[model samples]
Target: MMRLFIGGAVLVALAGCGETRDGNKPTGEATAKAAPAGWNAMDACATVGTPAVAAAMGKAVTGTALDPVSQPDGLRAGFSMCTFTLADGAKLTVLTREAADGDAYDAAVAAARKIGEEFGSPAVDVAGIGKAAMWTARPAALQVFLDDRRYATISLFGADFMPDGSEAARSAATAIARKLAS
Candidate 1:
């Protein structure tokens, strides 16, 4: 009887210790979001836009080659990333796998749209990255952004569709997008 009581007492004591895997204060879960492995980041606007399209007022926004910019902080060794700034100041990020044929680019675009949709803020503009071979759906307007294997792309336009370009914003977006690209 005495042995049984001693064993039960020890078990109770151990249970009270609240031990965890790392033995720390037992944080619930990691809040840091990480992208999947094997993805490269690219710029949003870097992709070759479609041949021709009608504007809202029945005009055309011709396709233009990507204008690459320098982003010192956005550059991570062995990783791809990008950023975008909407005229409204909403920031969008794209990360990793900007290669023509890679899942990271597709996944990043899809993830960004998912986030924007979840936000449910009508003001938020979410969009997909990539050209014909690898396009993803995203919210329109605001600041269109994309990141791929090559570089990060950032676009700025007001509610009136006036272009507001910024090299600095693009760099910042690229850095953040690279981190978010999965």
Candidate 2:
């Protein structure tokens, strides 16, 4: 399961490198939208280290410095990320993406779906996390599309990891989703 999960995540990350599965380029209009009104792209750093997330992990987690995403097109796309490392060297990454409108949001969802399909594990809808939420067990990742024209992905990685059904990752992701929604 861990191997499948890791493989799925790898496929997802690689899919982000270029055009969609249909070979269509993402239009500028879709990627040009701003983040929700109050969202600062930089806040992703703090979100990863929230007290709620620490509690869910059952251990103190230290966040790494914020890393700016550099896309090949140089479009900002309101993307930011940071990783929280646990005492056992396990890591969880928090990813924030701008989805100011339905077009952007839909595109993002499609991309996620394609990634899941590529890994032979299609995304399954998850209830109550956001406007729309999905989880791919093999990768043990959770993705939430909040009401604020923003979306987030929580990915788990480490030598010691929990199964997808475990509450730890889901709980932490939910806690972060609540923060993002607010």
Which model scores highest in lDDT?
Answer: 2
Q: Write the per-residue lDDT of candidate 1 for residues 29-130, one digit (tens) a residue.
A: 221333344332333233221211111122333333322322323222122223334334443333223222222334434443443243342223333432
lDDT of 2: 0.59
TM-score between model 1 and native:
0.24
How would you encode candidate 2's per-residue C-alpha lDDT over 1-182 as one tens digit per residue?
Answer: 44335434533543333233344544323434444455664566765455756776777776574665533233223566767777777877777665323344555566776655655667888777667888765466777776435567777776444543455666666667766766
Root-mean-square deviation (CA) per prediction: 19.5, 5.5
Worst 10 residues of 1 by lDDT: 48-57
**Model 1, runs deviating above 4 Å:** 1-97, 121-139, 142-156, 161-182
- Residue 74 of model 2, lDDT score: 31
**TM-score per candidate:** 0.24, 0.68
List residue ranges in candidate 2 displaced over 4 A: 1-38, 69-76, 162-167
Name the lDDT value of residue 65 in candidate 1: 30
Cα lDDT, model 1, residue 6? 21
